[model samples]
Target: MDLHIVDLIESLNNFDENPSARLSNSIIISDYPGLISYLIQNLSGINIKILRQLLEYIPEQILEEILINETLPSKLIEHIKTQPPDYDSIKILSDIYDESIYEQLVDSEVLSKLVYSIQGAGPKMCENLVKVLVFISKHKMQEILSIPNSRNFGEILIYRLNRAQGIEKKLMLKTVTDIIFSFPDYFYINDLKVVCDIVVDSLSNQEEEILTENYEALTALMDVKDFFDLKYRFSEIYEVLQVPEGNSYILKIQDRIYSMISN
Candidate 1:
């Protein structure tokens, strides 16, 4: 074994022996740039549990530096692929603002794994996975749209939308909105219509926050170039907003849609 590897392992072991020593250990690691580099470079050899612990104490700026390592993004994807979803790792990856990490993710075909993992995921995992998807869609829309299975991925998003609720559903809606705005041509007519239907259906939701998201999602859909052809799909919106006295909030949303389509 390399002497440096042996020394790192020993030091990690010592940190494990005294859990409360994390503050001092993090300080020592941060003061030595070489040690931080060595740790990041040899991440594959280190135990995940230990790495997760060490990450907690690392300063945010230093952690951002560590995240920029080209290998780290791929490694995080591989870890999610080979093991059950690691919320911490996924959350970290989602928080990464580096375009290089997103490029690595695109090259690795991380989308399919992320979508597949959404099934049967707990709330936190689902939130992180969707956040990552949203991030990729925002930064690498063209690459994602060019993938052969991109349409299938869209279908999965719609399917999940049908089954999701509350915040998950809202996030899913935002992700779908982002993709549609970026690649309106990619979705078939029926897909576009279904998205319209989903948004209109969500208007009945009583939660004020969800109702607001539904309104925003609806307005976003109307902005899609393709949505004009499918505007009839939202014919039901008029019926939904109709009231004896007319609720002010619902009326406002109705007015916005009418104003958007008329312009």
Candidate 2:
């Protein structure tokens, strides 16, 4: 074994499950490959405790790079699923936006695990998970929404949207709207009324960006036969534009709503 790998093993072997042990001989970015190799070689004996601690210290970029690679080991993925999904790492991975990574994630069942695992994860982690789902939806709209757990994932996002505020709320709205715009078939058939209702409420929000995104999504929804339910909400939509301080974007939203209802 390489001297550093030897030292790393010694450190793990000597670890007493104490914080200080984690601090001692900690894995850095350069050492991740060695750690991954060690984990792969000792899959049966891979120490979950040590692996969790190591993952906490691994850089987000390195973790994402590993996930994006075609050779990402199942053992490593299993360990990652065993642990809470890291928000920073998921965020980094979400930025890659490749269909292969999406396919691999679905193939390995990592994406489903991540989606189902959202219930107990922290709010920020849940937000990042939704962000990752949104990115996946952008490339593989049908593939992602068709996951067996897709409705669960969508429900979690709607639940989060209900409780989110400020930028977090905007992000969730963007994600939901992206789905609504891109996959009208799934959006209409899926039990996604909560998502649609929340987005409709957001159309009346004071934030221009949120209102614009929601209106554009609604406009897209207008093209779908089943989404005429939004017609009933036009009164509330026009009410929002009644605000005296409305801006140009608000006027555009008004125009959009008018065009949809008129035609």
Candidate 3:
């Protein structure tokens, strides 16, 4: 039988909470083309969870189709930048694979709005938002970093990194790593110096996960030849790791960086 999304949507509206999941499942399992665009264009004030569920059903080609519209990026960004930043919807959106849509994201000031949302978010919600930002950077680092406010982008991320704790802090460090390595030419030397400082502090975290991530990030930053120009900071970083009888893992990180810088 031929299926229509509007009919499915109406069926969804008529159902009470109990059966909605079943109906949503039916729609998703079908994987019809144009379904995602239909939802975006026709739906208004839809619950973000429902929207995410629907978006998750969409294949990547359909997602690219939805973004082909000039207006959709701004609409999607506005939807994501809601009062708390919609984590589920943004998460689904972040998986977008098309490179062309990233230009539209920059035009919509997605980076600026994400930074604003990060400023006030409590820890739980902040991790979700940071994940969305990280995914965007993962996919579109060069395009997003090329924009004029990209330094502000780096600074905002660093500011968050400075105050973040637990898992959120690890996510921020990974985002910083992506930024530092992906667009070294986009950020100024001074901005990188600040990032190096943050990575140095992160390396001192006792958790092995954070330590491993910071070590990898620090290595990437140092691999950039310009980072070596700031040679004076190396001893300070080494000394920070030298807190008498630190973890053996931390010592290994120190030894690795020492090996690199010594050569």
Candidate 4:
């Protein structure tokens, strides 16, 4: 016998909880494409939010269909958006963080849109996006950066490296930029200078990660001609590193630069 979505509507309506109703309704919708398609065509007849929440996953076509459902009441539609920002905006810092960064984590779909936004957006836009990604983690950050057009993720990050001002986030930026270099076509001259500068500066800060990352950056820079220019621009940095209060790590870098450029 051909099944029907409406036939299960009565039972679906009987449940107050989301999970059971979702499981039951899924069984019905999957059983009858014709009736499900017909109900989808007449979306005004049911609560799209509940339908969306009940579905195991929202298909792109189905979401597109739902978006076009103009007959969906504004109040009910607003309720669908009742979900709040993932972070409490009341506790946010105006200068240190971006408001849009908090919106990126609403769900995976929002996060995906955010990653795409970073690709085409300018440095400021990518700045907030990277902050959000790092707030998430190296693994989640990789997921966003791995998507096509994600090479630009480093652009904002490198911009941060140059402007970073002896703060914890600034210090952490060394590792973040290093991660960005993993991209096949990234690590441009401007980016390299900013990263190398941060790496060298970390010598005073005495961060082992910074020293290690700087070595790798120098190795990477050996291949790029503009790296020689970066050395000239950063000439004063080696002098600071050479003073050696308690930082042989940084002094070592100064010696290496002297050796490389002197020869």
Question: Which candidate gets the maximum lDDT versus the true structure?
Answer: 1
What ranking emerges by TM-score with the best candidate at the front? 2, 1, 3, 4
Residue pairs clashing, model 3:
none
Better of 2 and 4 by TM-score: 2
Deviation of model 1 at 156, angstroms: 10
Q: Which portions of model 3 miss their true places by more than 4 Å?
A: 1-131, 240-256
lDDT at position 120, candidate 4: 59
Cα lDDT listed for each candidate: 0.63, 0.60, 0.61, 0.48
Please write out the lDDT profile of model 3 over residues 29-140, one tens digit for every residue. Answer: 3444455556666434554444554445434434555556555566666665554455555555555534466545544456666656555556645555555666567666
Report each candidate's C-alpha RMSD, comma-separated, in the order given: 7.3, 6.2, 8.2, 14.2
Of the two candidates 2 and 3, the one with more favorable TM-score, higher being better, is 2
TM-score of 2: 0.57
lDDT of 4 by residue, 1-263 (tens): 23455665444445454454365445533443443344445443243323543442434324344334433333222232353221211111112222344334344554455556565565544555566555544445556665665555566667665665545344346446446445424556666666666666666566554455555555455445556655544555444443336777655755676677656
lDDT, candidate 3, at 179: 69
Models 1 onward score TM values of: 0.52, 0.57, 0.50, 0.43
Off by over 4 Å in 1: 1-21, 24-26, 29-35, 56-58, 68-70, 78-85, 139-174, 180-216, 221-256, 259-263
What is the model-wide C-alpha lDDT for candidate 4?
0.48
Highest-TM-score candidate: 2
Candidates sorted on lDDT, descending = 1, 3, 2, 4
- 92 Cα displacement, candidate 2 (Å): 9.1
